[model samples]
Target: MLRPVVVGLDGSRESLTAADWAAREALRRGLPLRLVHAADAPAAGGSDLPELSAPRHWARRILRDAMDQINERYPRLYLSAEQIARPAAEALVSAGGAGELLVLGSRAFSGFGGFLAGSVALQTVTRVERPVVLVRADQTVEDEHTPDPEGRPSADTPYRAVVVGVDAVRPAEQVLAFAFESAALRSTPLRAVYAWRLPMVRAVAEAGAHQTEEAAARRALTAALAPWREKFPTVEVVEQAEEGHPAQRLLSAAQDAGLLAVGRPIRPARLGAHTGPVAHAVMHHVRCPVAIVPHE
Candidate 1:
């Protein structure tokens, strides 16, 4: 099983923005966003305080309050929060797991105000095993518009250039639907890269032969997506059959991509409840933020 989605919220403006982004995404993907608030609880009561009196237990309560306030605004969002005695980034990193997408809002950590980029966000994004999205507090999302060769708006983001990894197993159809819609939203181009390697076939020697395989792969991919393409005629499509590891091909193709979408296939024996080879590698190596559509 892929792990769950989690977002870190520390009651800061950036954290709140992160919460908003996470909530909206969870709603879109029909998944729950685990909102977390790690607080600093005093290890021991101050010596000055009278021993007979009870110390205030506020850390856990504070977390609950923040979570409640968030849920009130996004009532439909399924969220849960708890307090723990650890650094906020560490708390978030600990929550990372299979299928989980970690999101953080950007801002400086010093004296109450600065730019959106923060050390915590950077650390989480760079180190996590699953996908991490570092969103600016002021990040305003807009629909993608493909520009023509002359740099003009094309067909409302053409649903073109949608890419998906196909291994004929585990990844659900819902992932495909998301890829199609995302491409349609951008009206850009559509391409799929399925990397494969045979034990005896040396790939470096057959770059030309791989071109033919790429063509055939395109046909197979088209056949699979035939219904969707017929339904949305404006969407252009392409496919790549590369002779290498699946993960490397995906990372290479996604380097200049607007959006990279992948499926978290069912847990494999070796992968241990994680996204398959391609998605896992992309999550770490790609410079672009990826949309990990869990094969739910």
Candidate 2:
């Protein structure tokens, strides 16, 4: 059976927006959509207290409302909902393990143009083995497509390109596969960005070495992407090899992109799970949805 696309929801607009994005992605992947609410367990002796029961009641309401909204928007979609009595972070990580993808919503900064990942979302993203996608509250279906000739948002227009941050020296197969498949599904181009920096000694001493380093970087990027290009012949590939921070280069390339994908190397729990700096930066600043694929 095909695993469903799971979305973690709270009684917030951001979570609802994430549910909506998950619904569309589920449709695109021909998978089911599962809405989950992680409610706190009632106090042992305080179960009879109205305050304790009120939160659980509200949790059910959140799930119900999300179901109704998604159903109205996608009548033909197969959907399911569940309310888990556990801590938010724990529940999200466990629920995501059973699904193909786990999507969480982020709150956009009030005055800034970036999104903020809350403690719960951050914990889940760092720990979950399954791919986690972070969607901003302001993201809409129209934002995933190119504007019309008159420069108006329109879903009828073609989807924008999908961008992926590639590590030329150690490109993760899972990351490339996911990126190529996403672009293939949307019939959009795939922009592969590889960023590197020269050693300080080389930078200061060998001023003419930049051309050589850049050429090598481009070659490495092409080699890393050659097999993916063959695997997805129809996915137009745009390779960008630049000397800079990976996150900065990816952010600039993804300015008009539909989706941005990056890889997170899995580390032992004993060593604490981290999304890494590149994934962290892109998830916060990119307007497009960001997918963090966990790889070994």
Estimated TM-score for each candidate: 0.51, 0.97
lDDT of candidate 1 over 145-198, digit per residue (tens): 245577665644432244666553233575666666656655656766666664
Q: Compare the candidates by TM-score and give the number of the best one.
A: 2
Worst 10 contiguous positions by lDDT, candidate 1: 138-147
Candidate 2, 151-266: lDDT as tens digits: 99999999999999999999999999999999999999999999999888897899788888999999999999999999999999999999999999998999999999999999
Q: Residue 103 CA error for candidate 2 (Å)?
A: 0.5
Total clashing pairs for each candidate:
13, 0
Q: What's model 2's TM-score?
A: 0.97
Report model 1's TM-score to 2 decimal places: 0.51
Clash total of candidate 1? 13
